[model samples]
Every structure is written in structure tokens, then in C-alpha cells.
Target: MSQNREMKLAAYLVGTGIHVASWRHPSAKPNTSIDIEALQHLAQTAERGKFDLAFIADSLAINPESHPQILNRFDPVVLITALSAVTRKIGVGATASTTYSEPYILARQFASVDHISGGRAAWNVVTTADATGETALNFSRDKHWEHDHRYERAEEFIDVVQGLWDSWEDDAFTYNKQTGQFFNPDKLHELNFKGKYFSVKGPLNIARSKQGQPVIIQAGASLPGQRLAARTAEVVFVHWDNIKEAKHHYKKLKSQLKDFGRNEDELHILHGISPIIGETEEAAIQKYNDLQNLIDPYEALKFVSGYMGNVDFSKYSLDTPAREIEFPHVNSIQSNFNEMKKIVEKEDLKVGDLYTRFFGAARRDGFIGTPVQIADELEKWFTEKAADGFMIQFPLLPNDLEDFVRLVIPILQERKLFRLDYEGNTLREHLNLKKPKNVFIQKTGASKSYSKI
Candidate 1:
């Protein structure tokens, strides 16, 4: 891809909230996060901005240990479906865990969303993370699956889901009321999928979705995570605080695609980013600073510590330099720990400062500047191949989204960095990915080949 046309940006909206504590600021309408009208407006705003998709993150088990103030309510797929009804364009992507779900049920849910949305849905595959309080939620036991095992199950789970999706041929539905037949029996095939973790019987009740299957997205940074993403994900979400690290991951991930016998273009790498933009760089800085004041130092510290593998930093004084503290092994999010270490060593960050820095860095790559400066940074990342695009998150709800759509998007449009209008109805078509062939249908002689370009 040409540098000018390289990056593809999408907006991330999780529930009615963003990933920042600053969201409770006076300017924020906290109540609007769950409001249907508010969400519809946000979706429309994203479409107007010419963004690629509206992404939502999900967790099967809520973290009770975390501050109660942080957890908010809304089912992702349901919310996306609601938003889909209000908007004509823009992809609707939601995170769904493979470990907690059955393949047949999930396939139907996503396929139904695709049909309702006219092929704008995408599925972000995730393995459930371990948090202590989830035992009551019907998790098998108090223990979380070993990292490798969870991903192994995820791989098989995805296979079964895809198989079920292909159970009916594209032309299987006849709607022949005159003949008293709703579907052609000969065109349907049974999955009979028996995997290590699950055994699913037969065809999905719904017809093949408009996109064949919704676009697959993954966000695994570990070895197993990366492998799953390389083989199955069409869009890979990455979190890298530094440009060099982001570039390295991009290259390595794209290289892994070749080993999977997949084309590199079939997968897109999108770095998570938090943008605080303004008319001028100084104004943007002021806005970012103001938002930082709302941060509860204790809350920030606790969150960062857990993210760095549940390493307790309470032993160190808040004023003490970060380097003085010895780090311990954190099983969860190992890459995040390494990145945090680099930031501390390079910047000589103190414990107090670490919380503030981490607040911005942890959500997405922080970009605070004038529209021109933000655009220039985005262009650099795209041109340098540091990221194929970004998953843009706003610290403040509507205001942050409003500013980006009004200011930053216009600059990108002028530079031809973003689309002025959507070119296709389906998410896969928008991303330039070919529709996947139905595996079951191919086996039944309803289709000649199962591999789709």
C-alpha cells in the first residue's frame, strides 16, 4: 500500500464509557453512555467522520477487585445491534470470548447481527481473563485455564463456529411459499464438529450472513495470542506505547501470516490510541492536563499495578523513582510489563508520575496536539508502517468524539488519509477482504471450493 493510502482508522467505544477516568469530568455526560439516542448519535458521528468501524470491548466476568466506580453495564452485541439500526454505514465490531461461549450460539448471534446490520458486523475473539470473583458466574472452577490451553480451545472453538456458519449454502434459502418449502434440504450440511473442548451438531438455524461471516478481530499479544491472530484474525488490535515497539510487532505479525499460508494484506494491525486534539498544540496540552487533574492517584496506581501482572507497588513511596523498585513476574499481559519497564528506565519516572503516564499510555498510544500535529503523527505511523491504522479512543465521551470528527477528520480527508464516503456495505468489503467460502457447503457439493480469496 502507498504511504498516503496506508492507514485505516476506526473508533473504539466500549459500552457508554471510554477507558479513561477523566470521563467523569464536568463536561462529560456520564448518563449518556447507556442512552440509546446518545449511542446512535455517536455511531452517526463515526460514519460522518468516515471511520472504518465502531469497536467495543467485552469481558464475561467483571473484575470485582477493581473500583466499583469503573464498572458500567451494557451488553456489547446488543448495543451494537441497536446502533446498527440507527446508522446506515460504519462497521460494528464487538469482543466475544471463545472460552465462555458455545460455537453454534455465538455463530448465530453474530450472523444475526450481520443480517440486521446489512453485513456491517465484525467479531473480536478473546479468551476470558482471570479475575478472582468470576467463580460465581459459572466459570468451571476457581482456577483460570493455563494460557496455552485457553488459546488452544479458542482455536478449535473458532473452527467449529466457522463450520456451523457454512452449514447452509448461500442459495440454500428458497422462500418458496408456493412449493411449501422454506429452504432446500439438499443444500444444507451438518457440521458434526467434535473438538477437544466442544462438540457441536449440525447447521445454524439462520441463513449465511450477508458478509458470509462477520470479520474476525483478535487482540492477543502473547505467543499463543499472536499465533491465533495470525491464523484467524482479519483485524489485530495491538497496544504499544512506543513507535519502535509498535513497528516491531507489526513486522513480526505480518511475517507470521506467511507461515500460516495467509496473505499479509488479509490482516490489518491497528494500535490503540487516545487522542486529545485541539485547534492548537498548546490548547490540546491544556485540555489533556485538565483531564489529568481528575485522576485519582490511588485508583490509577491500582489499575496499573494489576495490568503489570498484579505486582504490588504499595511498598514503594509514591515519590520514589520507579527504577528503585524491583519488578516481579506478572503472568498476565507480559508484554505490558516489559513496555512499562522501558518507560520507567528511559524517562526516570517516579511512582506518582508513573500512574499519570500509565493512565495515558495504557489505554492506547496517547496523541495530544493540534489537528495538524495529530494528523502528522498519524501520517508518520501509517507511512512508516508502524501500524496499518489506529483504534482511536477518546478520554471524554461526546466532546472528544465531536472534536475529532469536526477537526482531525477534515485534515485527514484533505490529505486523502481517510475515506470521504464508504465504498461498500459489508465490513469485509470495506476492509478489502474477500468473503470467506462456506466449508460445509463445499463438502456437500453445493460449492466447488472452500478457499475464498
Candidate 2:
């Protein structure tokens, strides 16, 4: 791979696999989701394949009707921290909700992880969107924040978190035995930040790690979400199954960078792909079909409901055309809701059609193929500016994930699209993102003064 550019790959870890029916797969290891050893192995496998990072998605609350993966899972941030200890190179990241967490506490937690992981930590920022209003109950609230309000809070929330991260300068700590001073008071800055959602007063106890701070990861596709990503996220994860849509999204997000005084190179966009690789095309198709057959219709419906902002689809007959059912306003994943609406309008899809077509365990229509064939598609997407790389959501844990590492990755490596081995230690270095300078230092032009000490 050239020093100028290379495909950035991340493993989206879901306990059994990304597939909703993954736990039911014959080859899947039972209880793997809660098994610490199993999770460690998955992270290690991604590292072995030289993947840039391993990410874990999370939600604030779950119920009997919720997806299987969320039913029995560790807190994502904690799991990523444990996974980081087992893997040396692969960046370990997990979703953390800004809505439910205080900026100071969340900032401290990720900063601590960065130090523990040698700066390979990343925080996937989300304003928890629970249409069921269940998550709000968990957080001691009767209702969820309105969509626009959540984003407004998030805008201030991230500003507070990043400000907290810059509390201590890089050279703030001076273990000067000869002198009485412990840290340079002049270098220390407190963030007495007061915003609409958060008021944090701090010089965070933790210092910035090897990579300055944990990488900021975001996956919002709504207008507000896109704006947030444009302003702060170093990595943006997207899920667009087709090239045309992906290209448009890519170009639009990149174009927005200039508005924030950001360059295109400062951020990376990783499209989500749940590939079902097999020995041949027939084998791949069969593999995908087998998983599709295992999906529970009710579970699939619940998944779609969540995406559509908890709108009940059970009242309608399964055979009823999606258009016949009046879709209500949604407060959950806006992009997903809009995309599904487009699908409903474009295709003669019935309620039942969603189970097999749109609401599967994983989206595999574009990626189900043999290794060479999958590689070809990936290359085309990358070359065509559809995405910088992909977030590989393995549909079946260990089984599918190992198949990708053993079969597909080698082909990507051979093509020089991905690195044969990791070239840097920290997540920022792995992604080729520059270490962010301390805000106070940058403002005061004290970098040279600090270096003198």
C-alpha cells in the first residue's frame, strides 16, 4: 500500500455475529456474546488480519423484543478496554451515548482507555435515540429527547468532552526530583465550560496519551448528524448498500469539511459491509440463504420497528403492502427510516418483504461472493470514491470473521489495497490522522515554550 493512501478496515464486533439470527447458526459458538475469551479472540483475529480497528455498537436499553446481540452483551466501552489488552495493533472502539452521559465523566473514561490501550481507543459518539422511550426510563426520565434537541445537546456535549481532553498540556507533568514542582501550573488549563446541555469545570485528572486523545468516531446520517460529523468526527461510519448512494453521501460529507475549515484528508468514511464469503459463488449464496431462513419474522419486524422509530408494524397483515400502511413520524435513525421509505415507495414491498429483503441479520446483497469476487467489488467501491474502506460486520462470529481474515484479507493485501502489516501503533497513526494539538497550547502559541522545558 502506498504511504499516500490505503483502505482502512474495521471489524464491527457483534457477540455471535452481526446477523440477527447469528446465534442460531449451526457453526456459531453458543454464549459467545458474553464470553470474555471469545471476545478477546475476535479482536485478536482482526489484529492478525491487520485490520485498522475493531468496533462494537451499543444501545442504552433492551427488552425481550430487542435484537439478540443487545440481550447478552458487556458494556461496550468496558469490553473494548478488555479487548485492547489482548490485541496490540487493532484500534478498539465502542459506542458511548452523549445523551445519557456527562461530558466530564465520559471524557475521563475514554482518556483513561487511551492511556490503557496506548492511545488505540476511539469513542463512537451517539445521542441515544430510543423511540420506544424505554431508554429514557432507564436514565430516570419519562421521555426521550426530541431529535433536534438531542443533536443540540450533542453539539454542546462534544465541545465539553474535547475541551476536557485538552485540560493538561503534553508537557504539563514534570517529575522534577530536584525541584518541588510536580506539574507546571502555567501549562495546566481548566475548562470552565458552560453550555446548554453541559457545564463542566475541569482540568481532567488524566493526561493526553500517545495519540493526544482517543479518536472521535461518529455514524449519524441525518442532516444534524452529518453536520456533527463534519465538525468533530475523525472517522465517520456509514451504511449504504449501493455505489450511487454511497458516492453521493461520500461527496456530500467531504464537501461539508470545508465549511468547518477541515480538509478532506482529515477524516475517513467507512461504509458498513457484512460479507458472506464462500469457496464459490454458489456456496456464498447458499450461506446467505441459510442465515436468512433462520431469521425469526417477529424479530425482523421488531428490528424494522426500531429503525422506523418504534412504529408498530404488527397491527398490519404481513402481506399488506408497506405503502398501504401509514408510516408515522420517526425519531430514531432518521437516515435508515428515510432509506427504508424510499425502498417501500420504489419497490412493491409488503410488510413481510422486509424480513427477507431489507431487515435481514446483515445487509449482504452487495457482498455475498467468493474471495476474489468480494475483493473486486470492494476495489470498485474504493476506486470509485464510494467509500474510503469498509466496516466489516461479520454475520457469524469466529466462523465468518475467520473466513474473511483467511480468505478475503490476503487478497486485499496482495492487491496493495490494505496493509500487509500494521505500520503504526496508535489508532490515530493507524488511520493516518494527525494528533490534535491542545486547544490552550494552540491558542496561546505555547508549544515552543513547552518544548524548551
Find the candidate with the highest TM-score and give its number: 2
Q: What is the C-alpha RMSD of each candidate to the true structure, in Å?
A: 2.9, 2.9
lDDT of 2 by residue, 92-140 (tens): 9989998899888899999998999998999999988766878999989
lDDT of 1 by residue, 1-453 (tens): 464354677787743335456555777666665677877888888888878899877665556335322366467889889989988889999888887788888999998999999999999998866434252257666566656888899999888888878878889999999999999887787777666687777678988988898999988888899999988999988878778988998999999999889998899999878888877877887777777777776667776665665556666678988887777655445566677887878887878777667654233233888888888988888878889899886767677888999998888888877777788888887788899877754445544422222
Candidate 1 residues lying further than 4 Å off, grouped into runs, are 1-6, 15-19, 64-70, 131-140, 314-316, 324-328, 341-347, 361-366, 441-453
Model 2 CA lDDT for position 315: 80
**Residue 322 in model 1: lDDT:** 83
TM-score of 1: 0.92
Error of 1 at 380 (Å): 0.5
Tally clashing residue pairs in candidate 1: 1
Q: Give per-model TM-scores.
A: 0.92, 0.96
